[model samples]
Target: MSKSKTTIAKPSVLSDFKEITKMRLALSVVFSSLAGYLLGVETVDFKTLTLLAFGGYFMVGASNAFNQIIEKDLDALMDRTKNRPIPAGHMSVNTAFIIATLFTILGIGILYTINKQTAMFGAISIFIYTCMYTPLKTKTPIAVFVGAIPGAIPFMLGWVAATNDFGIEPGTLFALQFFWQFPHFWAIGWFLYDDYKKGGFFMLPTGKQDKGTAVQCIMYTIWTILVSIVPVFGFTGRLQLSVVAMVLVLLAGLWMLYYAIGLFKKMTEKAAKQLMLVSVSYITLVQIIYVVDKFIR
Candidate 1:
């Protein structure tokens, strides 16, 4: 008697690629760069915007791939990241390296076509993220501080992409996002404390989930809001905000701060999770408002 063999289905290449690139997160980062491009350019250049989007994605995508490869074993131990392609054995390390290398070249090359500084920042973001940040995650909580440098570069990268200059305006954009990262990241750290602990990453400022950490979240939220409103007061030449948009952006910031305050008061996982959600919404809304306000006024 002959028996038929059953064939196991493999995961689609698209899903594998998406997981490797972390497409959603990569795309969101690209949106920040896009917002900066829109704000910096007097006239919208669709072609450049399109290139920036692809370049930003590839840069960020490559960064994530390198991070996963570096942390594959650690990722497999954490509940939140255990299913990632590299950690789950769905993809090989060499394959990921190939994809990341190709992405790095394509992304930087595309950004270079716009301007060299833009490409330089993109390359720097990848370097800081993959080299400094990845290795430091297990060493100290300062890894978060190191990570934010690359994390915040996208906002300023857009301005440079448009103007090919690094001055007060791009610096202002950089400051806004840099301070914003503390609260946003700490909120995630608070809620995922145990999971992060399992993965040997201390993300909170105080090295524990405590009042000290919550207080810093509140403090940084305040700093982020203040920096966000600087353009409203006409503090920068490249970026300006109308009174209406200023009000709206402040409202969004307050919404995030409100949750940060909640985390400080209760210090509960639920509070931390809500704070994280609001923080994401606040950044996204603020970026949208900046672009819309620029065109409207």
Candidate 2:
């Protein structure tokens, strides 16, 4: 008798983790948190750093998972999101729900170990992102404003995790990110307007790719640039930015603004994509500059 052939199972654990966390997006959120923590803490504790990293991962993961769950149907409609685990049938809705809940609980518990305020912020981010922003995406363009609240929390959450309080330092970090999100997200909305339209998501202020929406994008980009340079005036308490760092950040912001202006003038998908890429680079580089300035100064 011929022996039956055996089939080996593929290694799926890592893939599942990546899918559950939306690792790329989670990493971006974690980077902002790390920058805030580094700026806030005079002396870094390895244990605290580890906890913050893990806590941020879980919190962002939970938010993304819940977002996917809520938008699964819409995801199916958009080419950009049609292949996500839930929408593509790689994961069941029930499984995704349980995973999201578990991650949220774990994230809050870990943050609570650091501080109650951090935990509260983590919970609030999840609540606002999942309950309010997710549903509002299809209803009104104001969802971006609601989403910015949660998006801005991670930056300040890091400072709270380090200091266990809300103060000028954390407030500044929050303000910087809060202003940054509008331009970053609006740039993405501009490029993905057709895709978003297919999914019933209204992301532009004017609900169409018109001068009004482009003008709003330009206004937000200007605000982001202004807030990014605020630290140069020594108004952010302990979160001061050196003149050199401020100049560097300002130059980067101007480059980003240039792309935003190009998008406004051309009103083409390519221009919007360029603006989106530049906006991402601006935020990431600004965070790095802030942390580096904190250490150098």
Best by TM-score: 1
Model 1 deviation from the true structure expressed as Cα RMSD, one decimal place: 3.7
**lDDT per residue as tens, model 2, 1-297:** 011111222434446558767999898998888888888887998798889999999999999999999889999999888867777666788998998999999999998999899999999999999999999999999999999999999888889988898998898889888988887888789889999999999998888888888788888889988988998897878889989999999999899889888988999988988988888888899999999888878
Candidate 1: where are CA atoms >4 Å away?
1-11
Which residue window of length 10 is worst by lDDT in model 1? 1-10
- Tell me the TM-score of model 2: 0.95
Please, what are the lDDT tens digits per residue for candidate 1 over residues 1-297? 001111223445567789899999999899999999988887788999999999999999999999999999999899999877777667899999999999999999999999999999999999999999999989898999999999999999999988889988999999999999999999998899999999998788899999999999999999999999999887798689999999999999989889999999998999999998888889999999999999889
Model 2: pairs clashing at backbone N, Cα or C within 3 Å? none
lDDT of 1: 0.91
Candidate 2 error regions (>4 Å): 1-13
lDDT score, candidate 2? 0.87
Instruction: Tell me the whole-model lDDT of each prediction, alpha carbons only.
Output: 0.91, 0.87
